[model samples]
Target: MRLSCLQENLSKGLAIVGRAAASRSTLPITSNVLVATDEGRLKLSATNLEIAVSCWIGAKIEEEGATTVPAKLLTEFIGSLPNDKIEMALSAKKILTMKCARFEARMTGVDARDFPPIPRVENGVAVKVDVAEFKKGVARVVFAAATDESRPVLTGIDALFEGSVLTLAAADGFRLAVYKMPLAEAASQKVKAIIPAKTLSEVSRLLSDGDESIGITVDTQKSQILFKLKNVELVSQLLQGAFPQYSQIIPQSHTTRAVVETPAFLMAARTAQIFARDGGGIVRLIMTPGGGKTPGRLSITARSEEIGEDQAELDAAVSGEEAKIAFNGKYLLDVLGVISEGQVALEVTGPSSPGVIRPVGTDNYVHVVMPMFVQW
Candidate 1:
């Protein structure tokens, strides 16, 4: 393949698809990216069996052909070169020659036929949604997905589409996150599937154009899902297993509630965590309302014999009586970090019950974190 393209365009395309190249795979082809020149453009493709990414960049094509080269090496080399135009040509014996102003490098390559064929979006139902909206939904819930592979279903986020509404949910036994958003165009029919977190993360990163919309198609029969943007496409294999009924775990009501600034609460929890190592990184929250109509004070405390103790207090809108609750510091901070809004509502039943954290105005998104028990 012989093509001339801008350095920035080529570098961006390589960075996007290069993520899917297997770092250590038994098959040598899996470690390489397929570069093909066609229709006056250069196409970059990479896959690791489960996930695949393809990107196209406008290029001056002198010859139409395809070749495979190591993804990391090419990306690093291209990134280090000057910002001038780059000319790439594949010669006989499968060698790739890259040339820029006053610089040139010849790299060994493999036959394009050795690369695995990426799945196509043909015959799949397409749903369109705004890029930023879709990315926000994924970000809110993807972090809650279980990292442990024992329960394959919990390791993925559940995506459900009904009418024009899209919902993303994830749970790891200890906590759960759910986010819902409206889609611009809905599929004629409803669709539900469990998509791995790794796949969703890649999709989120590929959505660089904020004004653009994304087309998502799912092939249930083949257990594959594809995401299409302006000049990029990603295909991933769906996780096979039934996700648990997470709705049953969410509490309907709580005896105590507090509305506090999201950033303030997160900072306090993080600081308290420094002293909570002995108790599995637990942080305690005590909500006490002063007399009259003044805002209540929420005090966060963490105590460990080895690390001493730390405490912080913040003003909050509290209802009900005084209450003290303990929770895992990391879980609380993770939920807080994903919320974009300013104010957060914390609903609790007691120390042993699960604490729910949610944005002040929205019921469409909710985070449930199980609290830990505190002695004395």
Candidate 2:
């Protein structure tokens, strides 16, 4: 294979697909990125069996062939080269020769035939979504996915499409996040599937690179989902299982509700985390109702045997009865960190029941966190 391409375009493609390449796997070929000539363009692809990413770069293809090279080495080498055009040629022995302004290197690679075939989106149901809205929906829920893969379904985000609405949900047992958005084009058929959080996270990043609408294809027959953004496409295997029934867990009504500033609440929780770390990462929220002329206030506190205590009070608009609840500091902070700037509403049924959180004046997203059992 012989081709010449711009340094910036090639570098960006490598960086985007490199994340899907396996570093150390039983199959050595999975560590390599397949470079090929496709209809006057250079196609770069990488896969770890679960997810596959392909990016095409504009290139001058002198010869038609393909080869697989170490993803890390090629990515680093291409990124270090100058902004000039890069010429690459592969010999019969599968050695890749790369040259730019003053740099020259030869790297041995494996034949492209040994690489796994990436799934393609052919005649599948496609839907269009607003890039900014889709990204925001993904951010609001992806972090809540389970990091520990004990429950495979929980490690992914549950994507449910019905008519013109799309709902994305993620949960780690301790907390659950759900975001809803309207799709630009209504899907012809309803579908539900669990997609790996890692894949969704990468797709979210790719959306920012372009201002165009994103195209999503769900091929349920092949159990593969495809996300198309500009010249890049991501294909991932759908996790086969039913996500937990999360709607029943969310409290219908709260005994107490507190509306507090997002930044102030986040800052107080972060400061308290310093002390909460030593004591099961516990952060307590105490809400009180206002009387005739007094304003309601929410008291945030954390304490530990080794570390001192931290306490702060923020004025809040409280409704219903007064209540105090204990929660894992990290869990609370995680939800607060991703919330868009504005006031947030906290709803609690009791000290032991789960607490619900949602941004004020917006019904698009909601988070439910299970309260910790603590003696107070």
Candidate 3:
């Protein structure tokens, strides 16, 4: 097999599919990227059994053949070459010969026949989502997913497509994040799937590389989902489990609400975290109601035996009864770090119940965080 392609294109294509190459696997082929010629173009693909990535780059194919090479070695070699044309040839003995302007190398490879087949979306319900909106939505919720694999369900993001809207939700027992966005095109039918957070995070990163909308296909029978962009495609296995009923955990109503600037709130949380780290990461949010002409005040405080206490106050448009709540400073910072809105509304029923954080003027997103117990 022989092919010639631009170095930049080959480097970019390798980067796109290299993320799926298995780092530690019993099968050596799992860590290799498949290089093949398809329809006069060079295709690069890698899979880690759970997820697969494929990328196609423009090339001149002399002899059509395929082979598998170490993903990391190929990517690094291509990335180090000049931006000139690169020539590659695979010999019958499974050796990949690569040549650039001033450098040439021969790398050992395996036959492409050993690589696992990447599932194709032959027929499935396709939905289109705006790239910017999809990335933003994913950023807001993916962080809430549990990193620990103890409960596999909580380590995935729940994707629900109904009507013309798509909802993505993630929870780690202590906190939950949910985001809804209007699809560019309506789905053919209702579809629900739990996708691993790592896969969704990769999809989000790929979306940022281009401004084009993304095509999503869900194949429930095969238990796989496909995401297609202009030049890259990602396919991942759906998590096999029923996601928790998240709606019931959200508070029906809040007894108190406060609107404050998100940046200010985040700063307060970060400052409190320094001392809170020694005290079980506990931070206090005290909302004091205003009477007559005075405006309500929200105070963020943290205290530790080894470190002095710290506090920050911000005026808020508080309504309903005053409430005080304690929460983990790190969790509060995580929620605040992902919010894009300038102002956020914090709602709570009481100190014992979960506190809900919503971006002001946005009804499509909600964040609920459980409170920590503290002796008053």
Candidate 4:
């Protein structure tokens, strides 16, 4: 391809697809980024077989061609160049020549035909979702997905699209997070998809690139899902398996409920995490009800045999009798950190039962976390 584009746009386009390129793949071509001319614009694409990302940038095309070049080398080189026009030309022998601001380089790359073609989900149902709403729900749900590959289904986020609402849920055996969001436009059909949590995490990052709305397409025939933005798109292979019934995992009722400030509770958990790290990552919580004169309080404490102990107390709006529970410090912090509300409500039936956490002002998000079994 013979084209000229601004250094700023080239650098940003490379950064967008760099993460999808395979770092260590058996197929050598997977490590290369496909640079091609598409509909009068320069298209950059990268894929690791499981996921693919592509972005288009405006360019002045002199000649139409395509080439596959080393993704890391090209990304770093373009990023270091000055903000000037970059001229790129590909030879018949697959050598890519580039010059920008007096710098010159010739790199040998594979032919574009050798690179795997990006998938196109033809005849797939299209759904429009508000980018801001999707990002918030994804951020809260993806953290609960299991990182281990032993249970493949648990590593994916269960997405249900029905009517004008989209529900996302994830669980990792220890904690579960569920979020329901309203779509920008009503979908024509109902669908259920299990998308990889890793891909959703990347999607969440891409939403911050200033896209007001995102287009979603589910291709069951190809077992893939596509996310398209104004100038970028990502396609991912869906995980094939049945997700557990998450509704049954959430506690139906609670004997004790405590409402406290989200920030204060988060800070207490953060400080406890430092001490809990060496002590099985356990943080103990104690909630006490107030009588006629005394104020209700929730006390957090963590102890380690080698290190010291941490204790913090926050006033809460507690009801029911006193309750005690213990949880992994990181898990507690993960849920509390994502909560945007001013206050959060915690429901505990008993120390052995699961603890239910919900944002005080919103009914769209809820979390159920299993308490760590420990000596009281």
Name every residue pair that clashes in candidate 3: none
Better of 1 and 4 by TM-score: 4
Residues 146-236, model 3: lDDT tens digits: 9999999999999999979999999999999999999999999999999999999999887754566999999988999999999889999
How high is the lDDT of residue 29 in model 2?
Answer: 92
| Residue 11's lDDT in candidate 1 | 97
Candidate 1 TM-score, C-alpha based: 0.96
Q: What is the C-alpha RMSD of each candidate to the true structure, in Å?
A: 1.4, 1.2, 1.0, 1.0
Query: Model 1, range 1-376, lDDT digits (tens) per residue?
Result: 7889999999999999999999999887999999998678899999999999999999999899999999999999999999999998899888999999999999999999989998886766678898888888988999999999989999999988778988899999999998988888887678888999999998998788654789888878888899988999999999998988988989999888999998898888888877876757888899886678777989999888776899999999898888888988888778888884599999888888899999997778999998888884
Candidates in order have lDDT scores of: 0.89, 0.92, 0.93, 0.93
Candidate 4 runs further than 4 Å off: none
Candidate 1, after superposition: displacement of residue 286 in Å? 1.7
What TM-score does structure 2 among the candidates reach? 0.98
Which tens-of-lDDT digit does each residue in 18-116 have in candidate 2? Answer: 999998899999999999999999999999998899999999999999999999999999999999999999999999999999999999999999999
| Alpha carbon lDDT at 300, candidate 3 | 98
Q: How far is candidate 2 from the true structure (C-alpha RMSD, Å)?
A: 1.2
The TM-scores, one per candidate, come to 0.96, 0.98, 0.98, 0.98
What is the alpha-carbon lDDT for the whole of candidate 4? 0.93
